[model samples]
Target: MVVESSPTMVTRSAGSCEWTLVAEDAPVLFPDENLAPKLLLERFSHDELKSGSHRVVFKLQTGNGCYYFKHYKISDWKSRLQNWVRSSRARIEWDHTWKLIELGFDTCLPVAIGEKRKGPVVRDSYLITREIPDSVQLDQFVEKVLPALPERTRRQLRFELARQLGIVTAQLHLKGVQHRDYHAGNVLVSWDETSLKLKLWLIDLHQVSFGSKLKTKQCLRNLALLNSYFSNRGNASDRRRFFRSYWQTFQTKKNGRPRGFQEYKSTLLTIEEFCDQKMWKEFARADQKWERGNRRLVILEGESEQNACRGVSELDRDFLKAVSQNPQNTFGLPLLNKSVSVTKRVTLKGEQGILSGYLTVCDKHSKPKFSARTAWDIGHAFIRRRLSTPRPLLFVEAKEQQWLVTEAIPNSMPLTDYAQSSQAHHLNFQSRRLLTRQLAAQLAWRDRCGFQDNHPTLFNILIQPDSDTFFFLGLGYLEQLNTPVSEKKIIRTLAAWTSGSLPLSGITRTDRLRFLKRYLLEKEGDWKRYWNRIDSKVHSVHSN
Candidate 1:
């Protein structure tokens, strides 16, 4: 395959997931890695086919932006994955997803099929499809907007997004497609402030199930994951709002009366009603399990008597400890993915094309909590904590790197996906704040270290709700700079961050950070105001 351009602007949504685009083609798609994926490259490049069992994305660029050809391999029976043996069942699964995409019901459509010259569409089939540009995953929206908005505003945004999930999933289910794994990672949201409504787009349909006979209960159960994911984050308020909005969105007038989400609204309603008391009981139960086993509630506070894990060094052990401490409160039993060893010492979840997984914390100390394998899971928690308050970043010394035991972000999200949602409207405000303190922090860190921030990820910036708080979970990355982020740089950039005052000099790693830093700054200030008001309110809630 002759290469013309390499893919530049290589990024993931602000959400916690990463993608493996036919990145081999990235170099040929862009002369420099400065711009976001260009649609020009996606349209022009003709990639040479590579033989192997891999989940890959071939990004093509056009005039304004880029799109991608997501390639997923159909699990082959005789292939290395065959040892686990689902036989023809998995192949049937790929076909099912493809069939639905072709149905125009909307999904990541398949661009190519994986098959041997002399074989049937075997289990190990490869399906390719064009990437949806300028769209973001749900979590990214929260990351960008939460830190900048007031808690009230953040809750509103979450409810609206959750409402979207309810209505959209209900639509998908009504249409007969069950996203077996309807977790946050699998959903994408789109929006433009100029546009009236926020939109939801679904992706990663390989796990979807649809046949002549649809499983309503199982499908509805899958849809219930939105409730589970949100509830665990201590967003009971969001659960109620989501439930109400979901019910309203799906309510239909039948025989001259409105029916509340009949297809799955009942289940959604039941789950929503029990969301509080039931969740408390479960967390309490998980706590009891942890307490009996001697553990603690690290991320979330719960009444469950379970003991969390204890006596852990901030390494791989911390992850297990956190899991033991929290046990499994929401989302039921955690999923185990096929592991892949990256180096002799580490493996990157190694689950073929699976993007989302169970996030288990370790039994490490209270501060600088950690996991032996990776800190990706903490990234989400960091955003959650930061959204609610100014949580200190507890850094743990590991083998060679330091992992941060972060607070759960209030209405947090990933930058990668945030770029694609209606949440961006609120980010306009947060971006102003991001410019000042937060972005300044990076520049200050750089000045202190006397080095430059290499490959600053705009994807790293996070925002809180009511659009007030801000944080960068990639705290350790800045330490590598020749200098540490300085107060001067941060202060100077404050205006630029919020106003988009700087010329669109083009988004660089450092500049992008500065751009997002502006949003973080504004968010931080708002949060300060909120705390002051809350603190001044009658001494305390009890006093009032």
Candidate 2:
């Protein structure tokens, strides 16, 4: 493939910024009289499509068509020095766009690029490209569009997408081009519904490097980065098809035949390991964000120098303070439950109409900070794991008292109440079995993740009106184990669920057996051994 030169290249100055316009025909780019690179740069601040810490992307409309405008801001001195010595990121992306075009890969069409410099350092840069019509991000396509298609059509589309992605990636590596930020979001997909024909384009080329052969480790790292999104959204067979396509496409006559079965398996495992590490690091980063106040959360000072952490967009400070001071008397709301802690139903009028929540005030031990922080951290951990739990709204910690507020899950009831309610009798056998299996599967997943609740009882679990969905409550007793849950702990959990002290209603012996079967689906131990041990423990508990 030969690179084509633009017929016209022009440079213009707007304030301190110098804009470079490259086009096959400059007159066709800005058909409107008022549209220019200077005006477009001015409009970027107000017409944002997406904004990040260092980048702002917006869409510009001209008589010709719509184009994407991306502005990159240099924050650190290191980047400024690098840009001063070398090419700016916008220039790199502009150059890479032509390189990709020459390599016969579909990519965004570059329109114009600009950079602003101070002394010898580049402070800001911009890149503009013509928008790809009827295109969506690969992740959005898989999440939103695929599910809407028929089963057969959806399967076919998925296969084609996986195959094309593999081919494109292989071609890039074969051309000695490596994309550092290779992920689903950077790939754009467009398809015809009638013929099911798909076209893919690579975007965000600022992180790309050209003319460097990819090593084995680099290949695996790139594949793992792409696989991170699909690991959650795609199934095993989908991933297998992808790897098979990649292996077939990546092979060359000089490199011999395609990989062997052992090689493929080993590659898959390595990629999975890399993906897991990436995901864990992301989770840890999110935890750090919560600890040091992010956009969603804020840390504030409470009465008497106490500490209060609240959701920025969810609850107000006044409401949080009122609830923390005297939850039982605040707002004259009805008391929901009382034992060791006081629970009050709270309602507040907000921008989104009525916001309902539950405020629980508990007496703290000597280490109030540790206790309060533990509950807050555990609640966030459950949310991070995508478990169903009432969202934590606020946490206030004082010397002797701790207040926690949680958003109320609509149409939810405690599992204990639901089990004894008339709704339980109305559920058919299949629905009841599904509910049992769901509960068991949740417990199994939690145990597999090394999380254990000290008292795993039905009372602490909330069942939605749908019955199949369950939400965990009372996260204060939750503990994250360093090792896998032991057989003894498993038996204890089972005993807690079926003990005579709780006396759960409507659950039969068959339901318990079914739950055990589903829970042991991925376990290595003998099912009979676990069943027998759980049975023994339950029997002993009931007898006592």
lDDT of 2 by residue, 388-484 (tens): 6887776766555666777888799888788778888687776776678667877876776567777577678888864357888877777877555
Q: How far out, in Å, is residue 439 in model 1?
A: 19
Candidate 1, residue 192: how far the Cα is off, in Å: 2.0
> How big is the positional error of residue 152 in model 2, measured in Å on the Cα after superposition?
2.9
- Cα deviation of 293, candidate 1, in Å: 16
Cα lDDT, all candidates = 0.42, 0.71
Q: Model 1, range 1-544, lDDT digits (tens) per residue?
A: 1122223323322122222234443444333542232333343654543434565455555443444444445444455455244433324434665576455444543332323222322323333444565567766766564444555565455666767666665556555666666767677766554333466667766577664323545544654555445543323355555556545544542321123334455665555565444434444454345434332223322225534223222224444344444433321334322231111111111113312222233233322322422332223222232222223322222322222334445466554344445664344444544434444544332333332223244455665534534455444332222233443343333322322322233322344444343334323345344334433431443344
lDDT of 1: 0.42
Residue 323 displacement in candidate 1 (angstroms): 25
lDDT for predicted candidate 2 compared with the true structure: 0.71
